[model samples]
Target: MTPASEPATATSLPIGSDADLAWVRHQVRQFAAEIGFGLVQQTKLVTAASELARNTLLHGGGGQAKIIPLISGPARGLRLSFIDTGPGISDVELAMSDGYSTEGGLGLGLSGAQRLVDELTIDTEPGRGTVVTVVAWATGVPAPRPGSR
Candidate 1:
């Protein structure tokens, strides 16, 4: 099915509070499970969402994220979109490279997100905004993989 055909659940929030981020993270975990993603994939997706939320707060001057659920028959998945109005990435190629971080800390956000999911897409321009989308799926289940207790 076309990516747009996937059923989606989206929430938009300002980036001024930690509480907002936490809530979004929780929702992401719940949504991932509903979409039938594996545990490893769910963890990775949640982490990626965390990174995007932080980026919106710190870098994008606050933005929004749209989480979409992709059900590909026997393989269920999720599509995450993080969009920000802040200055976009000047060098996406460099940013994706390992060990490259614009922030003072290790820059594992984008790169690590890319590694965790099955598909990754990015659109950004200097002065405009940034949009990062990631998709991941369950490997062997009609339903979501069991979560770790």
Candidate 2:
């Protein structure tokens, strides 16, 4: 695994509906592409974002996705954090399993998302909410644009 660093830039988008999910995916795709991720890698990150965004809206009752561009020495990556304040996961292990879901989903959102990104972290509490973070690394990152995202 590559070493990590602070985000060079960041952006936050709300996850309130299907339209919001599409918007998140588009932003992620654009950023991932700009940062030098290959087509396959970009797709993986966007797919994971879509699934987590859906979870935020449908299950968590709405939230936001904090998108961050990270740098590790000369390499770079993108981190996406989906946060919500609604009911949290009761069983994290179960939630990561192959065929488990709380919302009658085909049960592939979280599990499949994990397989897509370079790093994944899910923080939750029974009563609080959930924050699902995913990071995708780039093979060759060009110089990023200056200024805030």
lDDT of each residue in 1-149, candidate 1, tens digit only? 23433564555555566887897788889988776666777788888888877877777777777777665446677777878888998999998887887778688877887887767888999989898887777667654334310
Write the residue-wise lDDT of candidate 2 on 38-112 in tens digits.
Answer: 999998999999999999998899999999988755667888999999899999998899889777878999999
Model 1 pairs in collision: 36-144
**lDDT by candidate, in order shown:** 0.74, 0.87
Candidate 1 global TM-score: 0.82
Give the Å shift of residue 68 in candidate 1: 1.0
Off by over 4 Å in 2: 1-3, 140-149
User: How many steric overlaps does candidate 2 have?
Assistant: 0
Which segments of candidate 1 are over 4 A away from where they belong?
A: 1-5, 142-149
RMSD, every candidate, angstroms: 5.6, 4.7
